[model samples]
Target: MKLDIQHETHYEYSAPLRYSTQSLRLTPQPSAHQTVLRWALQVPGKLFAQRDGYGNEAHTWTLARRLWRGAIHAAGLVETHASPWLVDAPALPSPLLYLRPTALTPFDRQLLNIGAQALDGAPAERNLLALARLVRERVAYRHGVTDVMTSAVDALDIGAGVCQDQAHVFIAACRARGVPARYVSGYFYAPDSPALASHAWADVCIDIPGRLWLSVDVTHGCVMDDRHVRLAVGPDYAACLPIRGVRHGGGEEAMRVSVQIRPAAP
Candidate 1:
């Protein structure tokens, strides 16, 4: 299946920014399950600076920029940043990944306790599948419950969240269980649906035989398919913003993101 995606983000400042710099990770990855035929990023302002590279990683800015005297609008630019990397999750020592407990991050420790209460003696695979189902069934998939700043624990505590929140919980659980998990930001095409929406999911690097990295959609409770377009992969949202930027002389800034993803006509 082939999917065409168009994502546009606009930032309107209360006052003109003195200077601006941005880091964009909007390009998709071409792996075993999907392909990237064509893509582009449009910014209707000046082309001050940008960071274009491959792989799933985050950005950090040490210096800020001053605003130019004139308004900047950069648009309609083709970015040649695509890779045909296969999803090959290398196998880990079975003893290390499962059937044994490992050191955990502060957040991971809390998740382990939750899993112990919610899922006792359930195998890792079964636990993940069950967790995914629970997320969809228990949480009301509504807007306004969460924003970009909402954390995974907060969403779980509230019993409500969007796709990103679900993905975070799924990732946290998998990693807590010693499985190598990551966050996936991309587009999901729901056939015969009213409109398209940008989607997020989880990928676990199960060191099983043959396949290395497997993608899982906790929001939908299934494996990702052709309808699942790959964008970026990282440990969490901090590394997964499709587009990021920094501006100097910030009095007040209003950022708006409108992503329109649709299927190509047959």
Candidate 2:
């Protein structure tokens, strides 16, 4: 499967900001599942800029008056050539490592305990698979109910959430069990489904030697594939993003986003 993608983020400020800086992790990676054919970004405002060797654009927006916007558009979308081998990612050169606790918060620790209890005597992969299946079966897909900051416990208690919520729940559980985990944001190119174009998921570092990091999309209840176009990868959403900046202004700010995806013929 192949697709064309468009993603845009805009900010409108009530007052001009003095200055701000941000880090971006928006560039996609070439994994066993998919490869980046073409990608680019556009900033429609005054800002400073820098670039990594990989050409992932990182810009700093400064001296804004009323509004600022950053946009990204991509095309030539493709799916993973073959199904990801969950237990045998070692066959692939670039493998993910399991996460270890680093400055975990009290809440994070507690969540790990719960995850362990929930999947007693089960491997991390099996636990993740079961939990993901359970969540999708129990929770109906709905928007406007939660955001990035919402915790996994919160979503589970409420019995409702979107993809991000599911990913958070999965991450929280994995972290509870001393496994390293991260969040992923990208486009989900569902060939026949038309519910949503964008999607989010989580990855965990299992005990598997030389093949620790494996991605699982809890929302879709399947391993990530070529259709999964990655934008960022980190312990959480806060760490992984294409561009994140703040302006020192006094008033409220409005934001707008525009994303487009054109899929190739199957």
Candidate 3:
């Protein structure tokens, strides 16, 4: 399946910004499951491209001039393949590298307790699904309840959150259970529902015989497929945010994001 995706984020401020630099992790990863034919990122100023530690293509954009408002847009054409849950021979040094927890995804006592109970007797292939179930069951899919700053433990406490919260919970749990897991930021194509484009999921590296990274969608309660486009992977959203920056002066900020993902014409 091929897809055409347009993702744009607008930030408005009451006052003009002096200087700012934002790091963008918008480039899609061409892997066993997907192929990137053409992709581009459009913003206000010059962009310096580099590869992150996790191997995702990251770009830095420095503000060329002062502005009261800024916008970041990315348009791309990608051909996806029917890939199984397994990502064979990932370029990472070892799955253990993801064991460490982040501020947004702390493998704390509460999460560790959950992981211990759910994965005690589970098999490697089924561990991720079990974790995904735990996330969905514990935290209902309720948007606006949590923000980007929410942590996995806090989401579990609130019992309501969005896809990002779900992914964080699952990642935290997997790491607690001794399975290396990371967070994935991407786009999901729902043909009938073009409005729901941006998506997030969990990636647990199972060091079984073949050593595969399992892609788990806790919100959808299933493993990912061709409809899932891989954008970036990191310990948490803080590391792989779509648009994150530091500015000198920006009062009363307002942000709006619009995304459209649909099947490409034959």
The TM-score that candidate 3 achieves is 0.92
TM-score of each model, paired residue for residue? 0.73, 0.74, 0.92
> Residue by residue across 49-166, what tens digits does model 3's lDDT show?
9988877789998884668998899999999886746554556546677889899998689898878866775336566677678788899998689999999999999999999999
The residue-by-residue lDDT of candidate 2 on 20-83, one tens digit each, is: 5555555565666666676654555454556543223445545444434334333345445544
| RMSD (Cα, Å) of model 2 | 4.9
Model 3 steric clash total:
0
Q: Find the 10 residues in a row with the least total lDDT in model 3.
A: 84-93
- Comparing 2 with 3 on TM-score, the higher-scoring candidate is 3
Residue 151 Cα positional deviation in candidate 2, in Å, after optimal superposition: 1.5
Largest TM-score belongs to which candidate?
A: 3
- Sequence-dependent TM-score of model 2: 0.74
What C-alpha lDDT does candidate 3 achieve relative to the native structure?
Answer: 0.84
Q: Which of the two, 1 or 3, has more TM-score? A: 3
Give the worst 10-residue stretch by lDDT in candidate 1: 72-81
